[model samples]
Target: MSTPQMIRTPLTELTGVAHPIIQTGMGWVSGASLVSATAEAGALGFLASATMTIDELERAIVAVKERTDKPFGVNMRADAGDAEARARLLTKYGVPVAGFALAPKQALVEQLKSDGIVVIPSIGAVRHAEKLQAWGVDAVLIQGGEGGGHTGAVPTSMLIPSVVSAVDIPVIAAGGFYDGRGLAAALAYGAVGIGMGTRFLLTSDSRVPEEIKRRYLAADLNGTVVTTKADGMPHRLLRTDFVEGLERTTGIGRLVDSAKRGLEYRRVSGMSWIEYLRDGIAMKKATGRSLAQMAQAANTPMLLKAGLVDGDTSAGMLASGQVVGLIDDLPSCEELVDRVVREAAERIRAAGATLVG
Candidate 1:
């Protein structure tokens, strides 16, 4: 069979990928299996390192490399204690990209740049794109509010043009992009391609449990809600009874539990408890999030890992996009990517006719 031609963007050429599409780094869910599959299908895939230890990240990189000879990225917490170790693996393993899951410091950017790793931090606003670009990032992935997991407030339609207009580097649009029409729209807005989290989460390559996946499919357009009750900033999640319970909780119990979890995260991750609190304070200072909310933020990802990886639905929280309502079937990574690219190409051509007249 002849390979269908795609309108390769500068990013595609720069990263040695066919399309400019990327799979968003979902904590625990975006592991070796999903990341390798996407990379093998010719789109950049990011290994979610937010929950994984540095050694675990090393194993994941090797595991993906063993599965496919294609290039893939590893996503890391920008302020993580062992971020430098992940950077070392990127240089040692020749990882194609280093994706930042949070606001990165200048030192982290320099550490990766000196090793020749292409740094691309996912951003939700225009200023962030400019900030990363100024720090010598190669590209930016902008996730609009329609995106799943923890997301920004702006919608994809506005964020795409906003970030693209602000930065000279390649901009990848994300959020609520489940099909070719969405991908086509992103290109029209001047994005190199689209990035997807929920779309990828619903794919067969993703290792999310059947029951959880089904719950996501059962959600309605209004099923997802933004709540800072789980983490510091607004987080998009499936509106589950468990989630509602947390949001409704008051008094000393909530505060005590949050403090305990924060300590546990610090210990397990090899960070001093005081340092963990300091990080929370710093994040609060930077984002203007309240002290209580920042304390809650320290433990959110660990809770997410329990649900996503361990399938402990009762204990873990589900971070999802509002688009889960639109998803019904789980297609293989290859099938999903091909369908999206094909449909987008057709749509783009059809739209051209209207403009020419």
Candidate 2:
């Protein structure tokens, strides 16, 4: 099929991509191969850097640059101790965008803007979106309750228009989005674009284990669950046996497991105990999470890596959107993006034809 005619939006104009679709930065999933392929396919892609060391992140950034000349972004942890250094890397390498999962400090926004880097933070609430807009962010990616990973309780249907109306900047709707029809719906709701995590994670270019990908494909609409048992924060995950067990376990049992995972995470991440404490403290202040919650949250990275990278479905948790139920095939990024754009355009045209003058 011919390439779909481009659909222009504030996001397309701002990011210089042919499509307004964005592939979210999912830890252990959105690596250079996936990001580069998505960029080449004319969608904005973000490399997940929160799981990478500074040097590893730089290497991944360089690798993406080597693979694709198109603009792409890096997703970062704003409160990370090395946040400034990561920002500097983006500036130094002339990366086009910087995406944050949490609201970054005002100074970081200013610093990126001064260096001509676009700042797009992922927010889950109207207040957060408004604050980021006031901080002069280029745009905001809003994930609703149905989104994977750490998520809020608000569904996209309500959250998208709410944030869009509350802020002047473009809003990219995430959570429960997977197809051209969904993209059309988001536009109808006043969003400039759509951001997809589970959709992108299932793509052919994603580095997730094939076994894990197959597991995602087999999921149905009810395959996912949002539970705080994972890290004391509401996280949407595939209802795997491991996650089910987690839900069944008492608080004490879960805490012990979290502690073990936290240590494993520290060892694998090369963080000293002091550095880990600093990060935990930072998390405590940022999210107002108690010490126990912070400890559980610290283990999340490792838990995800175990599933996505190591293919340990028994013990590792699979972060996923409810859209997992809707996904079946693993098309390459190019094919997937083109198909979505084409389908959306056709749907929009059909919808317009039915309108009365």
Candidate 3:
């Protein structure tokens, strides 16, 4: 298919991409290949650095740079032990954008902005968006409870407009978005763009193993459930037998499992026990989470790796949005982005034609 005309928005203008779409930095899924493919498709892609070591993150950034010269971004935990070092690395590499889940401190935002990097943080509520705007972030991506991973209780339709009205900065709508119709709806909600995680995670460009991808493809709209059983926070996951079994497990059983996963993560991550404690301390201070919650936090990445990297669904489950039910194919980034833009343009034109006398 031929390339469609660009759909310009504040997001495209701010990030210098041709489309007003963003591929979210999903842990264990969004990597160099996916980021590069999305960038080359004229949409902004964020490398998931929160799942990588500082050195691994640098190499991933280099891998993306080697694959494409298009502008892209990196997403990292703002409260990580190496947060400052990672911020400096973005400046060092001249990355065009830096995406964060937890809002970075104002000083870090200023530091990144000083180097001409656009700072966009993912927020789950109006208050967070307002706070990020006050902190001088370039934009905020809002994901509601229908989204994957840790999410809030509100749905996107209610959350996006609330955030759009509350914050002066551009809003990128996420959660339950998969196709051109969703993009058109998001624009009508006064958002400048849409950010997709599960949608992109199912793409051919995504590095998630095929077996896991097929499992995601097989899910229905009601196939996902949000449970604190995975971690001590609300994480939306596919309701496989393993996950349902997790829900049925006792609290003590859950804690024991969490401890085991934490040890496994420590081995794969090559983080010493002391270093892990330091990182947990930083998280505690940043999130004000309880000690138990923090221990559960360590279970997240390793569990995700079990499915996404190892393709062992019995051991873990897939993180996905409600939109996963609407998706069935694994199109390449180029095919996906192009079709979205074309379909959106057609829909927008059709809407206008209806109003024309």
Candidate 4:
């Protein structure tokens, strides 16, 4: 198909991309191939750095640079012990944007901005949006309850307008968004763009295993469930036998499993015990999780790796948005971006035509 006409918005302008679509960073999913393809397709893509070690992240960034010259961002954990180091790496590479899953400290934000990087943080609430804006972030991406993994309780319809009204900075609406209609709706809600995670994770360019992608396609609207069993926080995931078992498992049993996974993750990540402890302490201080919850935190990476990377749904959990039910095909990044932008533009025009003279 021919390329669709560009849909310009503050998001496109701020990030220097041709379209207002953003392929969000998903652990074990968004990598060099996906990010570079999204960039070449004229939408901003964020590399998921939260799952990568510092060296791995640098290599991934270099890989994307080698593949495409289009501007893209790197998403990292703001609460990570090496957050400052990560920020400096972005600066060193001249990455145009820096995204944080958690709000970074004001100093960190300033440092990135000083280096001419646009800082965008993902926030779930209006208060968090306000706080990030106060720290001079370029934009905020708000994911509502319907989003996959570690989501809040509010739906996108309610959350987007609330945060848009609360903050002057650009807002990108996420959660439950899959098609162009969702993009049109978000723009109508006063957002500058839409951010998609599960949608992108299902794309052909995504590095997720093919079988796992099939499992996502098989799901219907009711295929997702929000549960606190995955970690200490509420996570939206596909309803599977393994996840159900997690819900049924006793707290002590869960803790023991978490410990085993944590040790495995430590070995795979090549982080020393001291480094792991430092990261754990930073997470505890940032999130105020109890020791048990801290242990559970380790379950996230390893479990996500099992399903998303290893395609072992029997032993791993899959994080997915409610929109999985709405998706059926695995289009490439170019086709997906073009279709969504085209549909959104058509919808907007159709809405305008309804206005009476």
- lDDT, candidate 4, 1-357, per-residue tens: 326545889998999998888899898888999999999988899999988989999999999999999999999998899999988989899999999998899999998999999999999988888888988999999999999988999999999999999989999999999889999999999999999999999889998999999999999999999888777899999999999889899999999999999999888887899999999999999888999889999888999999999999999999999999999999999999998998998898889555477
Ranking 2 against 3 by lDDT, winner: 2
Model 1: per-residue Cα lDDT over 1-357, one tens digit each: 212548688778878888778888888799999998998777889999877767778899999999999878998877665567778889999997989876678888888888888888888888888888898888888889987778888888998888888889999888889899988888999999888888898888899988888878889899988987776578898888778887887746676777777777777666666656665665665567676776777778777867777777777788988888888899988888888888998898888554353
Ranking by TM-score: 4, 2, 3, 1
Clashing pairs in 2: none
Q: What shift in Å separates residue 45 of candidate 4 from its native position after superposition?
A: 0.6
Q: Alpha-carbon error at 356 in model 2, in Å?
A: 5.2
- Highest TM-score among the candidates is held by which one? 4
User: What TM-scores do the predictions have?
Assistant: 0.93, 0.97, 0.97, 0.98
Of 2 and 4, the candidate ahead on lDDT is 4
Residue pairs in candidate 3 whose N, alpha carbon or C atoms collide under 3 angstroms: none
Runs in model 4 lying further than 4 Å from the true structure: 1-5, 352-357
Backbone clash total for model 2 is: 0
How much does each candidate deviate from the true structure in C-alpha RMSD?
Answer: 2.3, 1.4, 1.5, 1.3
Tell me the tens digit of each residue's lDDT in model 3 across 1-357: 326555789998999888999999999999999999999998899999888888889999999999888899999897788788988989988899999989898999999998999999998988888888988999999998899988889999999889998988999999988889889989989999999999899999888999888999999999899998887889999889999999999988888899999888877777888978888898889888888888888898998998899899899868989888889999999999988988888888778544455
Q: List the residue pairs that clash in candidate 1.
A: none
lDDT of each: 0.82, 0.91, 0.89, 0.92
